[model samples]
Target: MSFSSLLASSQNHLTPDTNNSLTYTLSELSSLPSTSAQFDVDGAYRLLSTGGFDAGKFEEGIAEMDVGERTAQTQNLETFLEARHSAFINLSLKRSQELSAAMASNLTKASRASSWSAEKKRLQTSLLGSRTYQPPPSSPSHTLVVPSTPGLHASTWSANQSFPPLTPSTSTLSQTTLGATPANKVLWGASRTLDSHAHLHYRHTILNETSTPPDTCPGYLDLLSILETVSPNDLATTSLTWLAEQQRSIFQTFVSQKVTSSSTPITSTDFQEYTTSHNITSWHKVWLALRSSLIPQALTTISTITPPSPVLLTRLKTGSGKIGYGTGDIYRTLIGKLLDFENIQGDSPGISNTEDYIFARLHRLTRGGTVRAKKEDLEGLKEEVLSWGVKYFGNVWSFGLPLFCAGGFEEGISAIKESDEKGNVRAVSLAIVAGRRGLVSREFYEEVVVMYCRSIEGGSPRIAMEYLGEVGRERRKEHVKKLILSTRAYAELAGVVGDDGERVGNEGESTPIDLLFGQGEVRDILRECGDALGREGGGGTDAAELYAMAGEYGRVIEVVNKELAVRVDSFKNGVEDPQRNYWKIAAYNFAEKHLNQGRTHVIERLEREDNLKAGSTFQLLMNLTAFFDKFMEGKFGESWTVLDSLGLLPRTAGEVSNCVDNFFSLDKVARDCMGRVVVAGMECLFNLHASLKQDKSQAAGLTQQGSAGGQSLAQQANIDHDKAMRDIRDRGRLIVTFAGLLHGSLGGEVAKLIARMEAYMM
Candidate 1:
């Protein structure tokens, strides 16, 4: 609450009585609540002026208003304001601290010196203010009565309520004697010495959190006492909720234990009873039935012995919290995707009646629809355009257009349709909408589709692509293909729209053939965009992403392969690239990204079935990806085995010549990729060779120093070492052969590496 509001609350304290004299009325004001934190000066002064509490202070029967006495009342008002301000600041400090600082103190106080409680009490009183509690005069014997401050009795507490009792015989109250309460509950009391006012102190801290020096009543007695504070209905409801939560918690624990340990499965209890109590009968029985059916299958998993400390973690959430597990997004997104939403069908159900949901999806999609939005954020925004062709009409389209503009999809078809819909849309668009329901024929689509795209506010040809995309399957591919070629002519005329330097436009208007338009590509228009996204500074598979969109799957492999080659091309063979593991993931997994999967599969099938050249290239990419995956996992032995199987690392003299012949005959792109592969293969061989020699030397020394058994083991080791060394030398022959066969800088580099390996062999 604001300072003004706190002061304004004082108005509720008293009513003006014109008949009362100043002295008697002043005495009445003294009876007000001690919590003068809500005292309002204007309210009190107005009442005084109207004879609510005498017109002036210290006047008694004097007819004239005394200025000096009035000044004292003004000082008192300042004091009241100070008290409220100080109290508010102190409260703010404590509240902010309670969030984190209270957790800072270890479970218990470090020191238990006698002065600890006294000092804490002094600190609380100084910060919060001096509380003067007067024991009710009617309390039982031995309770001291502390006089209450004048004028602070309005409604702080009723006079009839009993004061917090204390053992006046002792100087300090034992924490153990206090009644049980929840961890969060608080009780306030002040201590005063009948000896003097100077010793008075207020305390706020409870017995160092969690460590309650025990001596409480029986557990049931404590619960009964606590329940006395709650009404019957509230108590019943709270108890039911607590019981349900406990059951759920136990069930979760059982599931966790069964999943991660050799714990026995929980018995088949009637869990539906608990759910039915709360009316959540939707899937409780089904879940129980499934559990019963699957128990035998789950037995192997549950009974399997495993290491401890493993847990099937709870669902991950953003921040220190997460949205409930069940409310996951129902619709998949399309923002940066290269394909349309197909009917594999897990689309989120959006009711046309839900204006807010529709608007929310639109608000994000059209704006985040820009070229530069983060892919993750864009993934969510893609769910928006799914609302398109769904009951969107009239003000909904027009109203959402500007928001779409702000989001940067200004030249989008929806924006164009919204602007055109008034005459062009309300009638023509609605006709198409009606036609979509079989109200119109194929002729209707051919008639307005072109004019419809042209008539939209911008007359953007790219809008034609979106409209054609809405056509039935037979026309969709052909219509979109022809339109993609048409966009090339308009590409030059279409200027960028947004802010200076930003891919500009407003009201969701972007330049001609923006990457955001239908399934996110415009072919000939994308040619420039694809080139622009190509790996700058020789990094990333972004170029490959666009190629996948434009049906240039081969080009996608080439682009991604270039990055992979650079990433795997070590300064020294077998030494992994300095780039992080994610670089490899992006390059190798490029085919699996959104919208590319189905298209990638199509290309894979075609390449394997008919396209020999592309098929070899795709197979090579798969080989390189597999080799590096093992290499990056620190599994050099497995990586070498992969390279060997692919014939990149030949073991025999005849195999070496065959590998070299195959390498030299490949296309330039394939050759460039192979050159890196061979280099990495050599480095890995050298790494293995060097490590083997070290282990053999250690075994030789151990054998010379040990018993006859050690001599026998050493003889076996020497035989294995000779055989492994011969295999290593055979693989190295490929590098040496390439050096003499190809007289280039690469051969010279290879020749130098072979000489270093020879020294290690010696």
Candidate 2:
């Protein structure tokens, strides 16, 4: 018999019989003999054919057929002609059969059910032909027969097989409903089911109306395209809808999998990945979404909010999500909405209740500054924040308040010099809190001093300093003393701090406030201030302490400048502070500790400058010459060697040489060299102009007395000299350019200028 006839005959057994003798149970079939005996038709044909032709190829074929048919239909409409409709159907069916068979095998292996029965049922239920295959008649002799050919008479068939009866009244599902089970649903098909994971479902619902099996259905790629097309209206709705659905699925899945619950909390990682994948546009949205979920305790998980976080919250308040979206666009629309909300809805006292509700649920403190509050509204915000702060962080500047305050302070201080009003206030508040709590660090004190120095009014720094001392009291006094000692230590340790090292003691040096309060003398002054504040009323409680701190301040200067006078009495000699040392010893200690021979330059320059009898020019020359000597030493390593090592010598050699030719050793050259080099340079141009005019009488021949030059031979020599002077001027300009380049290479303008001078002399 043909394979189709055998398959047809085999499935015929599914029909209920009145007599139990004619049917066979699966158990009875196991007892049947295995045979390679070829039926009239090939086994391959039986596997390929529809009917009991149940195969994996059928489902895949169904999907392929659906795609081809729909695609062809769309193509037909577009081309203004019908598709080769019959030919396309034929192709779809063929592909459907091929794919269904392949898919069936895989589904069967994955299901791991008894026999190939469940998969076969799923496949059969999915196929179009499985609905129609009918059984051939059985003989009265209790034999099963197979026909040899298609549509041939039953009389031509031979009865070959018989089976025991299937148990009566046992229910067998219809083909369609068999696949209706949730797990049996085809993915991205009209009907689908939950998979093993149970977290993600095969959602058969279509996102786009035009999508179908033959069509590429909506998926991640489709979502991405939708995102591209999102506008202020429809796209936002769609993106939000899609994201909501996705989040819902994730939530449900996670719950179903026991990954999260009231009893078993979700991890931060789960929340992070779930939120991150959704293409959320702003930090506010991220915050809202995550805040809606419970915070996970997992340390490895990191959740970040988008945007200016507070600004995002403001935008959310405005209800911009209803407006629209843009590709790679920020939530400006949302922000506008938030501004409107804050204007209308945020004002009423009733709004505080709503905000508080959210805060309580989210484990957030309902603080005023956490949201949008303009300068005028800050007081209200402050009231709200302080209430929340006391409730959540307590009245004292302890626990969460300190951490929160510190961050705000840092941000505020950073913005203060930039003239940010809000930032400055926040910084000031933070500093006060820090000082009050006695939690202030050296860095914080330094920052406070710097801020005071930058204030608009005079003595603001001193006032600020006194305020700190007053509030912090004895603790503040101790800190002030410690700060003086620290500053001394820093100056002593100055060699490592680069050019701004001196400013560590006197930071913001260019600002008048720093000049006033940041000097060593100010340390003594603060001691007095602190002692005065420490007093009970008239004289001071810490009067002796104050006097002692002031004396210690003087001692700091003494130690730093012990070498100043040659006389023995000038030394701190038997001065009370145990920390005091003689000038030579201090210098030796500084030099030895910093591990550099060059520190002596600073000492020598200070002493020579301090000695007024040496004269101002002499002092300036001494300082300049000291700088020159240090530059020649090149503590950072030779500039030429560094450039050569970097292979930049090739590109920079000419510029380097030009700078060298301009700056050094012009004195031996007196007139010629000065005229050719020094006079031509930028710094010497004024001097050059003055030198070129030996006679005042010739000034009239030129355009302006100073503006014109002489043309006579001696005048010409002077003219020639003037020309050389111009060359020197150009050289100076060149030196400036070279200095800039050297700065980039050697690290600073001063170093570069010195290096260029050295190279010029070389």
Candidate 3:
């Protein structure tokens, strides 16, 4: 069979058979070349498995065929496939280029259309002018207009062409009926009309473009009508858009009008008129407009207005309710706006004294109940006023002090301190003034004292002392103590001694130390005088006198035992020797008074002193001291021994009489002393007599209860009793003699007491 015949046979067998199998004879397969031979099997297998045949792979397989065995049929098939693939690629490339060109052309046309539309709008506006445009109908929603010309290049549009203005009949165009027209397009077409209306309204009202008041402007009336027609939600949008167009013109006109009326200035009436004509309803809007426009001119105009006087400022500070302004809020806003204007423009020549103007205004605003000034604003005003005070008066305290007292007490103090070199005193004075006015706290006065102490030296103490006195007057004990301590610390720092009573430098140079030291010296002298009187134990002296005298005497004797004695001796040694005897008599009288009064503490205190105990006069003083102590303790027997040791007891009646007689010539204190001594002696004699009588009675009882031994004891006891009785009698007689002598010497109360004692002894 031929190769074509074999190929046709394979196709027939592969197509379908009764057994569903392909069979080829060996001769038929061997007739084809080997490389070409696999083609039919591979093609059939590839088509069945992959559902398609790869042309390239089929061609590659053909190239790989043995050169000798490769057939013309395979070459022809590969060439046909390559031609078909190339044709398909060329056709696709041509179609893609055509599509790209079409898109590019469409983009170019669209760009031209956009540019032409913009140019058309610009030219139309220029040709027609803004005045000829009419606003769109008022509606809740915005409307957009689209050009009706389809596929018309925007660049070819003529400027002379105009759209018919909307009549009242067409004014009700609803958003639902304006299908597919964008809101932006509608706004753009109507922008000129809106802008023109706003401009006309602003010019007529704010700028007075018609040479008539805003109240009579047709454009302003139209705007007010429009505002009334629009919903509140739309009003804000409408007003804002209107304001956007007229902002620059309105501001310039407001400023120009203000500048022209510099003398009269724009008052609240002017603002009211302006707002009414322009349909401005809110204070917030007014504030915005003023802030945006007439700030500088307003500042100048406000500065020309006469500043409120301090009295008016004070009244306004406390008075409530509106005066000329509408309400507190409106008044506050007005003042705030004026203040803002002034601050922005700075100092104005309209006011000769800018600081005074600011101060007066600030005082009104801050003190007034209507508005509250910020802390920074108050401080800034204070500084301005303080500078003026310092520059003109050469002392900030002149103004600063008064300002603080008025209302800015703390602020005034701080300002003065900052402005003055020697501001401590000024600050302190201001604080004191504030305190006096009850504007400052007790702590403020204390802080002033502390500041003075730490910052100043010499005069600080004196000033602090004055402040302390003021505090004392308030009965602020704690504050007074703090001031004293602070003054003391300052005195120490200044090297001031408390002992120095004289002024350290000039007459006014005395510090707290001098005052304190002088007070102490006076106290010492008073104490010494008290001690002298106390030790003398004068007739008229009470417990207070005795205690004071004892304390003083204790202190004196502590210094030196002989110190007190020397003082007394000096008084004695003077030509007036009677005074010397008076001193001795007073001292002796005090001792006798203590002995009679049963007071041993004074004698005990005197004997306890080491210095006095070691003195040369210790023996006499001790005997005298012991006599009083023992006598007061009811140790009459012991007191007698002390007196006997001192040789105070007279050896005979004549001597005793003489001693007592001499006491009468002494002063009252001395006489009292002698009288007490005689009384003590008589009491001691009476006690001895009682003891003698008891002893005699006991001896008789012993004798009565007798045996031989008892009898001997009784006899001895009787002998002792007899001797004691005799001694008692002798002592009694001696006391009698002493009393008689005292009765003779002392003629007043002393003599009377001595006579009583003599009678008792008898």
Candidate 4:
């Protein structure tokens, strides 16, 4: 028989009896469980087929026929039997007549019912009423096995043919495994055809019923420990892979709109139970589900990570010095996350309600609204402002400066050292904040001290002074004290020095300070000092002596006044005390006298001769130049040559000629210096001019004083007015001419002289 025919014939043994006996009859024994059964039956039929009896011939021929048939059928029958048995056993199928026809022509019907009696009895005696059985009690089904194993055949029968298993608990599973097995299970049952939906439900129900609580699930900690053992680089690689998966899953969720509404808390008890017991926390599950392929559900979640505050936004907007990434940067980052949370939660119900509340509070605070309405005051507001300021400042300076600088972004950062912030820009400082979020540069502290000093010395010197004094009292902060003191001195000087020269007294007008609308304190201070200086016989050092030494007339007056009031003894000499003041004042005075006398003598000689002084002008010019030159040469003589020898003075060999052109003009020096003191002089001249312009009656007192010396009207006018005008014009002419000669000389030779002269004045 052919394999198909034999397979069909083998199923003949299956027959449903009354009361579900599930037996088989030989007459219609369409199928068999083994090749032996078919062989035995075929042998019996062959034997019975002999009709006529013959002695030797019949016996020999019969034996020969039997041998030939048995040999021929041996291999074929074995192959056919194996096919039939495997089909019946593996498929649990019934055979058909058409299959028998297709197999072989040797089939014959059995007449006796005793043919399948043994098989029927065996089936009846079995514990199960039917051949099909539930899982575990029966041989396991293996229909889903890859490449089709024997176990799978049994499993399929057991699983499909029997009742489902009892529902199992999933609570004991570890969090880490919650999503693992289910995914495999889904893949397994996807192509099922027999009551596919119900089959799936049944399989799931059995697994669920059999599963232990997540907490009892094993391998969760092992996986985490394995993860921990990974190198950071490997971990990062893993994380990247995991993150990609998460993004995909989130995207899937978004597309499916499953996680969109999210009213069912992500933190549900079921989730907690599964995650904890299975070790399948959100991150793990997310990673597991999406690492291979990106899905919409995961992408949505990935996009949602952000910070919460504008303060945070401000910090992270760029890599400026103002903000950075340490504690403060971290805080800002958290705050930014919070802000993002707020935006996401916009009008949604049951969010934490923090970011919006904080935002509102900040808004009110900026608008001058009191935080604690009833208890608020200036101090409270100040405290709040300071709190925020400190947070911002600390964030920007503490962590930002270094990080931004390290990252090649130093635009906003200031010096991170304890030094000046003179050239610092806002962005650079902000970048510093970004780079080193939580640590301040040493410079930041120094800058604070500097600012404090400026505040003290700016609008209110006394306040500044008091503050500095307080700093001084704290002896440990000597540097701070010195800084403040220095700043105070600078502020005081700046305030006093401004426009003080506007007021003049020589022309009979009040001092400019008097004309000023304000500056009461400054005026009072000056007056006190002046009064003290003028007091007769009262001084530690005379004003003249101090002036001669330092040439700081205002300071001299102030010190003299204080000394007089305090009864300090004055220095015995009228001139400066050489040792105490470094002898610079004496040197300066001597230099000035020589310089003035040289100029006056040269000019007088020229005028008297009714001719130019030839190279005398050059000589006089050299005298002015030589003043500083000679002093420097003598004082710093060991370092440099003398002025005349160095060719810096009038070194012309002839009386008239070459070197004359080389002398610097005095006119330019006078013009430039005029910018500094001309106003003072003009104020005096203006008063004089005003007096001259007034009616003769108004000027009668001054006129009478002039006449008291027996001066005629013409003589009075000529000696006083005319002579004064002449002197003014002469000085003016000399200065203007000098300016004309040296206005734009790029060699800066005149500039060097101007600088030297300016230094000498101070």
Please name the candidate that would achieve the greatest TM-score relative to the true structure: 1
> What residue runs in model 3 are displaced by over 4 Å at the alpha carbon?
1-400, 403-634, 644-649, 661-674, 704-723, 743-762
How far in Å is the alpha carbon of 105 misplaced in model 2? 49
Candidate 2 local lDDT, 1-762, one digit each (tens): 332232233443332222222112221222223441222111221112111122232233333333232221121111211122233223434444234455445534333333223222221111000001112223232222323333211111111111111111111111222232222232212111212211113221321212443222122122222222222222212223222222223234333343422221233334444545555434334323322322111101111223122222222222223323344333333223322322312222211222211222112111123233322243332334333332232212211221222122232233332443333423443343333323345467445644542451132222233333322234544444444332322222111122311223234223222222334554455445444443434222133223223333222233233222222122143342222223334434444543245554333443544633222222222223232223234321232223223221123436566544433422221212122122112223333334444433353344353443534444544456546545544544554555464334323444444335434432
Regions of model 2 farther than 4 Å from truth: 1-378, 388-487, 490-492, 496-762
Which whole-number lDDT from 0 to 100 does residue 326 have in model 4? 43
For each candidate, what TM-score against the reference?
0.31, 0.19, 0.27, 0.17
Using lDDT as the yardstick, the better of models 2 and 3 is 3
Candidate 4 or 2, higher TM-score: 2
List the global CA lDDT of all models: 0.37, 0.29, 0.37, 0.29
Candidate 3 structure, TM-score to reference: 0.27
lDDT of 1 by residue, 1-762 (tens): 222232234334333322321221222234445443323433333222211222122123222322111111212222333333333333333434233454334323342222333332321111000112322121121222223343212112112222111112112211222222121011111112221111011101222212433222121111211222112222222222222222123234224333322212222222323334445322223222212222211111211211110110011111212223253222212110101211111122211112222222322322213344433343343333333322232233332322221221222324434443233432333333323323235565445554555553244454454455345555554554445434433333233312111223334555433433443334443444455445334324444444544545556555655555555544345555555355566644544442245554535534644645654665666677778767766677888888888765456666766766777776555666555566667767777777777777987888778877666353674557767876886677656676556555344465666657655654
- Lowest summed lDDT window (length 10), candidate 1: 309-318
Tens digits of per-residue lDDT, candidate 3, 351-423, equal: 1122223322332332222223444454444454444343333234334322331245566566555664445
Displacement of the residue 397 alpha carbon in candidate 4, Å? 7.1
RMSD of each: 36.6, 33.9, 40.4, 37.1
Residue 531's lDDT in candidate 2: 44
Error of 4 at 604 (Å): 32
Please give me the total number of clashing residue pairs in predicted model 1. 27
